[model samples]
Target: MGCSHLVIQRDFAAFFLHFFYQSWMLYPENESTIVSWIWIGIGILFLTTAFIILLVTHYFEQIRKNKRKMIQLVRNAETECWESIHYLQERDRERLSEELHDNIISQLNIIRLNINTRNGKELNSDLKRSMQLVRELSHNLTPPDLNGIELSDFISDYLVQISKEVEVLYVNHTEQDILISGTIKLNLFRIVQELITNILKHAFATEITVLLRVSVKYLSLVVKDNGRGFPMEKYNKGIGMKNIQSRSRKINAVYKFKTKPEKGTRCIVFLTLNNTKI
Candidate 1:
């Protein structure tokens, strides 16, 4: 904007200089009255000022149009992300249905048979497994804590649910538990979930580390994996990353990713905590 303004001023300066020269040439040196020259000068000045104002206004309008265009692009991207999120929700429902029928129902039926046969040990074993399955399903539906307190513990619990397949470690560095709004907590949870899902699905890494830090003024989350990192330009444009981007913006957070092929990846999220409940 500044460059455009400067160029306009420079061009206008030259154009006005030539215009005044031509106007001066219109009158002979002695024949031109002082009042007439003054009038001519005032007219030139007025036109120059008006043209500058017009240029400034035009530049401002262009800026507004660009801003609107950018907002529309974001809206379109977010709309696409919601479609992906909905697809994920549908898949979760299908998986839950299958687990209920194939695992819990079948296990319960076996326990019933064992009880009928007076098999106490077998019945106890089946009951334990059934309880575990139910707990897992419950966790999948809702996070461990709904109040948005104890975010580290919530993340720890989530990791537990997925740790059996791969090694996962979590560390909390905050001196006190952080109380965040439900909106922040839920978005962070989804972001964390998406990062881990990507690692598990594609990274093939056996070690995952999550670090949580909350201070009086700000909070940060770090998720790192020792898996094969992806190309920044290629893989970072996926719906998962775009979803994270939108969520980051919604919460006024900064989301950054550092990665390289075979070098592993680290994701960082930082946000101010001024609005957070103590």
Candidate 2:
């Protein structure tokens, strides 16, 4: 009975050893496969995280670049405004000096000469003409009282005066009164005057069309002429054109000139009324 018990115990021991060896052999392959899969998952997660970070960084960089461009554009516009103001001021000074020298001073000198001659009739005539000239100059320098007058009416009267020299057409598109400062009106009038003067002096044009449009948010003035158009390059080099551009900047208006040889010239000015100085 002792021998039979020993044989049974040995057999049980061998079966247990065989089962343990098989389990160990299978464990190595399964463990290796699981480890490889875990590593691959970790690598994929790391790559995805890195890609997300890169995308976020690029988006912020693009935003920063756009902001910088906007800032630069604003700075450039401000610089142009200041330069235009300075140029217009200087031009005005020069104009005043010319008017004094050519009109007032010269007329005074002529009156003085006539007085010394003691010709009553001629002196009377000269004095009257000189007075009239002075009045006109004063009117030119001073802004007319616009308390009861519409801007369109004023412009219409002005066009009528010029119509004798050239065919003039004026059109008004807005019924409501344009609410703007007196200074702005005066500047705009001066700009129109300058343009007309240029057309008369250089364009040799017989017909001119002026259009004025006022809306809730903006005002537009357009001057078109059927004349011998000058080259834009030549126009830019002239002081008169520069003066026009300067005035436009002073009013914070956008000015565009379209011209070609023998075709015609068109000048368009756009002024924003909303939240603007005008």
Candidate 3:
């Protein structure tokens, strides 16, 4: 074993000795080519570093431009949002004024007339009617208490009131009181209210059907009416329609209207509560 180990060491030493000798013989011949190749490599390294620096500069510059663009977009969006809020406020005030003038004030004027004519019975009836009108107006203004009831029940209750005037159907495909955030539910309720109001006022239809469907990912509310339909493009210009649009936006919902001249109208709103973006 010792003799074989010695033989292996001798073989390695001889091999290295021959290698150095051959390199020493070749060095002078290859010296200029080797030096030229080294300089070329150094130049390549410098060029690569300069190219990398340029690329990094351009990348950072692009990032800055994108950031500026994003900030400007945000500013524009904030201005638009404020404008929308003011417009909606003004519209709501106008609507309330119109309702007061058209309903209770007119009724009071009639009561005053009855009193002047010395008609006690008619005055009493007019007073009662005015009281009922006031009650209805107050009810419309006050937001419903949603802490105890589910969103479906609140909508269903509204449909029941509307059913007295029009044929109404309410269908819930999910649990009656499914777990949902209060803000999300409130926005949804407002959307439903707006849709029903629009349908009652504009759709001279005989029947209306409301469907609420919930899934793991999202929920959809659909209102369909069998009334004379108006073009959605034109109707969307109205204040009521704008209100619905705004509410849909708040809840990150998508709404579409389907209607023809004589055909009934179907309004669908889809909302995604699970999205953190909302």
lDDT, candidate 3, 1-278, per-residue tens: 33454565466556655755575577867767666755665575566556656766787899999999999999999999999999999878855654554345545644553465546775686689789878977777543356776778777865664565678889998634356776677777767666666666677788999999976568999999998899877887876676677667767889998998778999999976563322
Q: Which stretches of candidate 1 lie over 4 Å from their true place?
A: 1-145, 275-277
Query: Model 2, range 102-209, lDDT digits (tens) per residue?
Result: 345545554553365456886787678778767876777443466566667777876764675578999899646557656556556656766776676678888999
The digit string of per-residue lDDT tens for model 1 on 89-205 reads 986775565445434554565455336554577568668978987998787644234584677777787677456557888888875645677777767876787777777667878
Worst 10 residues of 2 by lDDT: 98-107
Query: Which candidate wins on TM-score?
Result: 2
Off by over 4 Å in 2: 1-142, 275-278
* Superposition error at 79 for model 2 (Å): 22
Per-residue error (Å), model 3, residue 130: 11
List per-candidate RMSD values in Å: 15.8, 17.1, 14.4
Per-prediction TM-score to the true structure, in the order listed: 0.49, 0.51, 0.50
Model 2, 153: alpha-carbon shift in Å?
1.4
Backbone clash pairs for candidate 2 read none
Evaluate model 2: give its TM-score. Answer: 0.51
